[model samples]
Target: MADKSTNNIELKVLVDKESNKVIFIEPENDFVDVLFSFMTIPMGTIIRLARKHSDPVVIGCMNNLYASVENIDEQKFWIDICKDMLLHPCNAADHHCNLLKLKLDDAEPRRYFMCWYTSSCKFLSYDRNTSSPCHGGVMDREKSLRLDPSQVGNVFVKGEIRFTVTDDLQVIPPIASTNYVFTKLDVMDVDATEELTINIGTVEMLNLLMTSLVSKTPLTETLLKPKQEPKLSSSKIINQAIHIESQMFGDPMDGDEEGKISVKLVVSKSKKMVCYAEAGEDFVSLLFSFLTLPLGFILKNMKDGSLRGCISHLYKTIRDLDGQYMISNHHNEMILDPKLVPGFCYKNSLLGIEETSYYLVNNMLTTDRSLISTEPSQLKVIGKKDDSALGFLKGPAMFVVTDNLVVRPISRILELHILKDLNVPVTDIEDQIVHVGKKEALHLLLSSFLCDSVLTNTFVADLREPKQEQ
Candidate 1:
């Protein structure tokens, strides 16, 4: 068991002295559970936590997306809570994660709010100042979730079990012999290995998370040595662009016209690449909504290993594990097919992800009167009925989105400045309309994680001429 008093946990790692690489690590129940909990964290929460770390981990183009939300004015949103929801998205497995020995995510646990007037009020609000439909007072009273005691400590994997995790974040059962591991890895010399005990804390965990997204040998890059600058070769970028285009255009698209957002791409004719996109509020809202999705949900929707990251191995480890080794079938499902936090879904979202339904006992009152002793009744919280403002961003306005997804209000002067910065002649630029539906949204979500040239990789790949015979 890990020490509950401190943030650090001890892990035994096997390293290859010759290559200075981490071969694998044998983890305990607490450590394994904490690693598995990465799937439960929301993308926005990951970015937020990464920025707070001593060594910040920058995700591909997502940092710009997150900053766009931060730079936008509060009045641009329909309600203030809309912006807050994007900045601090709630995790679906918050209760399970809160029990982990090393708490990595700093986002506060979900707080429930109820109307103050009566115990029978049917409406519930995530925000404290939201008015109830029952003509009741402000929903400022906090209520605790009634969790089952038996399920309190029921985390990801079972206890007292031996497990082996590879450097790429692959979790597997105990191997038969160390000789076999070395043989499988093609390491012939047994003398070229060393064993070390690592003290993992919040900082190490954050580094691991960052490395898992970009590096194949995450453990070595995180624990054994400092991370080097990432290099994307031209051939590799072309291959990645081709792969992304195939995934984006090969799939059968949804035929729903209402769900499509029209975006005008500003292309550089000489380069045959997308310079930027001009879109309305709905398009920007859809892009901002990506941060609200849970990591598990994103992985589940992406084409297998489409997003370049070692975290997919961790996700597959959870998905392919035996049911008996997990706390419950529900726990396994929570990690494999996680949902969004309640009220985090936007109406304009093309991904078709649904928010989890929350049920509460409507017996808590906020007034100074005598406490009611009536029997508690479990009722489903009433969902928002009005669609006056279906998203975070205020509509009837235009916005500019760069290739790497830097969003800002559209300005003629700014557009001209961007053209000047690109140093492209005005005649060489052309406008083309692109329709983004469920298929394109999924494509963007996957590309935003793996590549810096999201628009070029997703939309402009087909326009480029093929390489000539060398």
Candidate 2:
């Protein structure tokens, strides 16, 4: 069984004496398990944890998006649980991460919920407070679940194996000699290098997760350097302008593949910046869906797999790592491309992500011992039949998405307040119609990862470019 009592993982880091840079880290399987777990974290979970810590790490415009969900009134959503889902998103690899030496994700253990009258109503829910559709009854009765120990043991990488992790977060076996490793890192003078041992607890793990998302050198920033002041919200970073020259990732939009929603971008005439967007439920839902995506899924969709931070390198390592080094085939495969947890995926999502088909062992779904069976029943979806539309917001409503991605219901007074806040005159602001297909959706995702002015950078910056004379 994996050691669940350990609080920290010890790591040996090599640092350059002159530049004070981390060369590489020699970590055991436990530490590697922590590294691999970064891929399994949902985007919303990352933002939530960042805000929880004393020194919060700003992850692009996610802070604004998360705040939008919080600031919006509970009555605006389809149900109360919709807001709960965004604020505390679930990780698909929760069970796998429970076996790690250090647990960074603090989400409550997965609980099983079913209708109060389970004998007659077969509906199941992850949230106990959800109102049942059958009888408007609360699905608060908890059911005991039995997990197979053998299936989840020995997490991530194999034990008794030595590995070398680069400062940029590349994992490789230590097949080469120490001198050869030094040569690869360009360490000519061994006297200039020093070794240090550090303990990685939950705090440091959270710091590493934040740093890895923004900085290229995570180990050096997380360990050697002092903590930087927290940039808690997007409002703090919205003053600066950034231009990201990146190739579009998805296929070109055809007539049939065009977007269902047409967002109106309000741009500044003089500054050439997007102030905000006037959109309906469909566009807001698209932005909200980003929180549900696993890190691996977003990285996989990017054809080139290049982002602002070292996450791309980590993804490549998962793809390149040999199967022999992993604990099990299932372990390696799941980490490479994780899916959204059940009930969280949108059916007509523009990004084209799907939730995994989850089923419970019906025989063990009951708490009573007498009801248990020697032979388990066939796997079932354990809930009311989903009609393919599992969304967070109600329809026919308008919302305002600011440059920083703060979302709120649209109002005439609010529009005037925003214009006054930006000192933007009505004459200076021009509206542009933009269609959000797969390609534009991918660009928005990329900008949200790297830029602070998400709406301006993703939609407005392109309009300023000179058109080619075809």
Candidate 3:
């Protein structure tokens, strides 16, 4: 038999009479279950509690009014203190059990008067329409008037006090409406306007726009993303250093089976730039290294280890020739491959690449390109003995590693004697002089002879003619 002792109630007198140690005992339910039972009541459940100890109703109301204080003891004094407001101006009313009503009269700025209350009840406005009728909308009135302070009538006291006041206080004649007027306010209406109008374009565009709207993304965000900028390659760096571009030319020799490749290599980065061109195989090998790197991004990942292998394959064809860079197909030109022709201007992060290559031989070859020459003049002969005279090729001359006859004036020659180191050929010849008008004829002939094809080494003049073959 389960008894009420299982889960019924608790009552604690708490304090021990002798030692004053208080203890709590529950007769029915635990404190947790009792608290949860109060919390679990379905919402809107009417809890009609009787005056649970009389002062609690006033205390609850006061708690609702001033939530700033927490402890019940702190604000408990206010509940008793507010009773002073209950002193109604009059002790009794004219009718205790009957209802009192208010009606409005025509006034310019309408005002409301404190109509009627029993035993000093407070007057709050209510129009009969039920839904939020707090602001009184009395019918058949021009304006409702505010209650005059003179007729305040001790609101806390009971009274049948009325007055005919001269002026009005602050009150709206007719209350404003809270509900919205009927118009485009439904969810469907707003959503319809937001929908896109699909008449033209395509699904791609529509999907893109939808994505843009949903994500708030922009075209610049996708299209203008930070590009993986290309770097400038070594070949591209060298290519930019070449500006006045000249076209590749073919071998102009009368019966040669191959075409010649001519390209100018700028030797210095200074203002007085010097340039040289080559005729054949020597130019081919030099152009091979130049063509190794294209635009940076194209071959940026190519290993440098591959270059030696590629060059080795080329060396087998040339058989280590000095004047000519050997090529498998003599018909082909150096650095004149169609791939070297830049299709478009490369604009990358590091530097831009722009190169122009055209076939000059195909355009105008037979046209004479030499400067005009004049006839030589005669001078009086003299047996002039020179005490101090300089020999031909007084300084070392610079030449490109090619067959071209180009001589540079030595502003200053290199200190190291490379001819003795490289073991170049020696010549046995006596200096001969021929006088000419306005020209040192001996100097002119020797300079040309030093650059002649018979001279095998690149710069042979600097090597003194081996002491006259004994």
TM-score of each: 0.83, 0.80, 0.13
lDDT of 1 at 156: 74
Estimate candidate 1's alpha-carbon lDDT, on a 0 to 1 scale: 0.72
Against the true structure, candidate 3 reaches a TM-score of 0.13
Q: List lDDT for all candidates, in order.
A: 0.72, 0.71, 0.19
Off by over 4 Å in 3: 1-338, 341-412, 428-470
Name the runs in model 2 displaced over 4 angstroms: 1-6, 113-153, 176-180, 229-253, 257-259, 303-308, 359-390, 461-470
Best by lDDT: 1
Looking at model 2, report the run of 10 residues with the lowest lDDT sum: 240-249
Q: lDDT (0-100) at residue 14 of candidate 3? A: 19
* Candidate 1 residue-wise lDDT, 1-470, digit = tens: 23345678788998999889998898888888888888878899988987865656667677789999999898888777778878888887786788887888776776677776545666666667677778656778877654433454446776577788889998876644867766766667768888999887776776788778767888898788866524322233332322323322234544645668888889898977777889998888888988988888777765354334578788877677755677666567667777776567766677888765544434532211112244434333443423446677877889989888999999877778777888877899999777787777877876676557778767775633222212
Clashes of each: 0, 0, 21
Poorest stretch of ten by lDDT in candidate 3: 164-173
Candidate 1 C-alpha error for residue 206, in Å: 1.0
Residue 466 of model 3 has an lDDT of 21
**What's the best-to-worst order under TM-score?**
1, 2, 3
